[model samples]
Target: MDRGTTDRTLLSPERRRADRTRLIDGVVDVLVIGGGVTGAGAALDAASRGLSVGLLEARDWAAGTSSRSSKLIHGGLRYLEQLAFPLVHEALQERSRLVTTIAPHLVRPLPFLLPLTSPVWQRAYYGAGVALYDALGAALTADRGVPTHRHLSRRAALAEFPGLRRDAIRGAIRYWDAQVDDARHTLAVVRTAAGLGAAALSSARVTALLRDGGDDAAPVVGVRVADLTDGSSFVVRARSVVAATGVWSDDVGEMLGDAAPSLRVRASKGVHLVVPRDAIDGGEFARGASGGVATAGGPDEQRPGLILRTPTSVLFVIPWGEQWIVGTTDTPWRLDRDHPAASSADIGYLLGQVNRVLTRPLTPDRIIGVYAGLRPLLAGEADQTSRLSREHAVVTPAPGLVLVAGGKYTTYRVMAADAVDAATEGLPGVPESRTAQLPLVGAHRWNAVKDAAPDLAAAAGLPEDTVARLLQRHGDQVGAVLALAASDPELARPLPGAPAHLAAEVVHAVTAEGALHLDDVLTRRTRVSITTPHRGTESARAVAELMRGVLGWDDERTDREVAHYEARVAAERESQRMPDDRTADAARLGAPDVRAAV
Candidate 1:
């Protein structure tokens, strides 16, 4: 029940071409229009029900908000304060499933130290809330993946996280949640779907919806797709079209020429900061229980991440490899949805808030990466973006188009199932959602294969730690990466400038992970873009060359890929330097996207 089907796991260049040709030549039961988590989930959901599904993404998978999240699959403790019990309960249940069953290797238990600034009343109030959260997890989850909430004294909390300023807390509350490599997890989902009878194609942009009728009464029959890879255009017929485009939901109406569904999905920009472990006061806390970098989704230990309350929202100090992931200011965003810019003021505000409790405050130079993502919230009368609803809505303004929008990352599966249910409403012999029992591609055999990391590393002449990290990222597919390294001695070497990453990952990004461009390899496939201070500029050229043979990129094309990625990184750096969003947006627009086919 847990094993992924053997449809087509390797999404190689050959696979992409064949799938594109197949999609152009025939019709699918369902066509998913986004490559983010939700769209990937929708494709999986429909495909699992024995329906033909075609997934299309303008860029690589998880190219948008899915890649740039807080990276926590949590129950949202703040939502409890707002009395959204059902949402919290649902998220907690999903968290339990992900950690225990669905993606154990990709999602894991992460402890959080919530330093309390107030006295007994504040502790009592928050204590009850956390207790309720644990109770919900206990009731919903059979295995109960994470530890129960533990109340910690100020001294005890300080003993665990010495990075915190001593005077900032009266006491502390430690709770357990889950963290995921958001982009990797999303990729795994899409890959699993592809492995389970789904035609997956990235770099394919849907130009317009094809319909039989010419008027508003016309039902969508297919999509006019433009392949960004070859600048080729084609059309694929579909019985149902599910649009899980998140922040780009409004654009569907524009695509439909004013006949599309009316669903207001407002954008809330959330900015994150990636800083080095040494930037914090505690040095030894950076090491995990497993003697490697302390990671949120990796093996858990006394190394707990920090969660502090800010004036507007909560700020998290998450453990990500050698760096700490600090984030998220929720404010309205009306600019470009593709790449939401994180301005200098945004970073300043974030640092200023987190520094209030940090014994060793981080400077601007301390930040290795600053990325921003937009949250698609269901809009209502509330003007503030934070006040908008996180619950999703499914609508069919036309006969064949199903629009699902406004849900949190934690509830993506539920949203996708709901969307698929709507899309396949009148379809014949559709079974119930089987994704609950379906494990992603790498997850099924990970538990059995995980402990063999050291042995496998020995056989491959690589470090045990490298093999270990590979298992966590690729799960059971660690062999695929290790084989690449074993075949090529150069790939076994650590990537230059970003030595934390191995060169083999670059090649694997192309052959298996659907990485079409240099940006896809650096930014999403592996986290070189965010982890390295160079923003992947130093790794871009070597990475491009590694991918050249796999993708048939000649000398000039490979050079262009490297150059394009460098320019994009420069543009992002320029954007982050600007004082405000408007200027930042303008600055970020300096380097247009490399795939300008659309």
Candidate 2:
């Protein structure tokens, strides 16, 4: 009733805390650390339950492991071999929820095919395994929407994928899964949490955890936060804390002193290469005759065991918008967790695996982009790193400290729910979680909006493909973007170099979404950084010009943004050429951020 706060907007910074409140009031119901998908999810969960939530990130949103993932949302088929039935089943359930109920706009079913190498027993064994995979999913949800597994004879497989070596495949098997833009999904979760009244700020690191061990271990009270954008510090108090830092969970745990639990999270490095779609001959799902095995999320019938792969991780070649995404080597990592590099060895391994099955081989010259990310694999006894369970844990080390770690990208929601539940242990009358039923910002009534995509396209005077792309990226939010275009027809034009992206989206990222830097908009908001021919460099000037007014960048800042982005692209290109992590990291470090690194 007291209009004490200035900005009443759901996500405005002023609504964060009253001016009278010292940054160190250090008193809130929940203080969530980490800006990955899990941390964002935890903030949304806690805030939705009527808890005073403040989420702090050491870097930009999705800056770490969240942005660097295989970008798939699926029940782990590989888990079946490990006999982790429950984990697989749980992930499958979450996957279904994401596609149908949660974030349909960002997640979609992808198809993949697994070619059979051996002649007889391999085909039967693999077929049965795939049957089990499909049947498991079918029982969990009505109309899982993913097509059932399909079997293909040797001739049929070869006909479907002519790029495959004639002698390599005895037959084939196919299955289905889902894929996503991991970084975008992570940011969406964070933005949705902000919209729900969560105090979410990135580029702010938690320097210390306040412990009142003398007062019956008063629930972790607050955190010392350092603004990475500028050399300033503030104290944010909270009644409870949730640490959802993925591979870096140990750092957060140490802040809790002796109260920190003995938790181990292994880091597994995975690397991917981006190439032009035309560079590799491939089918729609690599099921057409042009490719060896197209891993886009379909059942494979040729192999002994059913396998489902995406263009992002499969041994087969698959197509992205105008490019192809390939390779994913799961190897142990013991270096700086911040910027994982794709070594020449990692690249060679993937190229070798894919080339073994392809009629034409992929060379280094064809690769345009490469990215590497570390997975927070739950540690296990020796000889089991790759097999480590993905089930996340949320443990309270001190009165105010709740540390969460070790979960797959698909199960982030569940991990978040658990972390908030841990943080609200002694809080009075906290409401139950509403995230399960809460559609993300873009998910409301997507069905209706999708049906109207053609009309929207006609109105924008763009091709249907452009409209469909917008719908996939923004869902119902497309209306807001379209309205902006209507006000200024110039906003309706496609961004240079990235024809699929509308100029309005770039403007929207700055004005609405919490994108404070050029990298934020290009790399996360629009994904032009990874999915483009020039890796977003070709469109850098246009994007910088569009943001000139919103970000208040003068000619110098605009030039700095463009120059920074170009250097970044060049560094990434050079990093891809390095033989090992040390060399690769040096190349990447050549382009330091204009602002201080978080």
Candidate 3:
């Protein structure tokens, strides 16, 4: 399809209204529950195979574990220690597929430094593991987009990362992995699937499962979905249903009636802290303290990133634009899943672990944002959550229902392919998965569009950096966003609070992306919530006003939306200050869900 036609295929409000009608009218080949990365991938895989598909999500896309990931697409380096060679190998292959052909715009290469503490044995120990990691990646994909690993001397390591305390590290090993805006990548997958004729709907909850024979022996046939936006329920008939809910797998499994779930999902909470890049970098902090003195090469130029071995788990201090993302704490969590609360202890644990290696310590005041997510781990004999397998499993507890669980974000595509493969059993003429070779909506002509970024920047009257950021986020679809700016020059202006994003992008979030609420736009559609000091509260009103035109919200509705978003931010901030999970959960629950309130 042409670009304009493709843009029209977006999950806009009009398309969503039409999709609801079509979903209730037709019997589709496959119905997917959940709109996270895996479910989105499943929709794309099934739709591209010529199967009629519909995907439904209870909340916004990537509102769960998918958005709050460590954001690295790597063959788990630590998985090698557990001898999960096959798992690591598979993830490495998928990583290459993502960085090269699939969604190159969203995913890119990033360098990491693994510091050497002990002199000789530490270097050799890490060197062999990293070499094997690189070798596995090279063997799996012909063009492993990332570079190989190399060793650095003590002096060389210090030169590369001045943030590391000289006494803390002996040397360092440099390696390459890929990173992504996880939420954006997930949304792009959904958009790509929708363009391929898949029915994608958010804020639609699966209230119950439909049966063909109305008994325990009966096969699962479809689902009764409740439109959370309008409080209307409709039945979507399908030949098969795939439950891809991450942490809520068991809850869906209950819909099987008397059939016991073969697998159980354990929630492991992981929290991340977003702080200014200068917080942990000594040189930048020193420069800032000295009346904004300019440095030749900035803090990021000096230190790419760092990964430290903590007592509980590995801590990664990743470079993200003008900010640094440090995390994460892996602990057992049985609290609320909708809003996983990161307690004061969780923040303290991360800060202490990361501070162990840093020359300049990071305090609570430096933290701009904090988010917690749960990993849907397969229940195993291992008591510790870290020991649970990263490998995924696909099970058919009933004739028509397929459940997929227990996989890392890096291997979501493989998990989705497996789920669809299981769901297509006994069906005739279903084609093999073509998603591996199929690039996402914006990725098809990304290289050509990226090459023209400079000219596009000049024509649009935007800084080259702004255009580059747009290209990385939107790929060839950047033209559609630029078109909005062209028609209204004001749309080209940067957002007042979050200057990294343009106002046009906010409008695109509503018109093109399936952003049903202001929280969806601020937190998931863009990184404004995490990147800004006010947690996007300062820009919430402006974004809501921009969205009002597209959504047809009146003045009162706009005020309500902004107020709801602000309440959510306040609750999150309060939760972060709480001492324990119990108090944190209570604090987070203080913010009423906008859908529920409506």
Please write out the lDDT profile of model 1 over residues 45-73, one tens digit for every residue: 98888899999998889999899999999
Cα RMSD, each candidate: 2.3, 5.1, 4.0
Taking all chains together, each candidate's TM-score versus the true structure is: 0.96, 0.89, 0.96
Off by over 4 Å in 1: 1-7, 282-302
Q: Number of the top candidate by lDDT? A: 3
| Model 2 stretches with alpha carbons more than 4 Å out | 1-26, 213-219, 285-318
Order of all candidates by lDDT, from best down to worst? 3, 1, 2
Superposition error at 295 for model 2 (Å): 16
lDDT of each: 0.86, 0.73, 0.87
Worst 10 residues of 3 by lDDT: 285-294
Per-residue CA lDDT of model 3 for 1-598, tens digit only, reads: 3866586558899889988888999999999999999999999899989999999999999999999998889898988888999999999999999988898878877778899999698899999999999999999666888778889988878877788889998899988888888999999899989888899899999999998886887888899988999898899999999999999999998888688577999999999999997786633211121111111233123236788888756889887777889988888899888899999999999988988888888999999999899999999999999888878889999889999999999999999999999999879988888988788877888777755766999999998778777877888889889989998988999998998899999899888998989999899989899999999998998899899988999999899999989989999999998999999999999997888864
Backbone steric clashes in candidate 2, count: 41
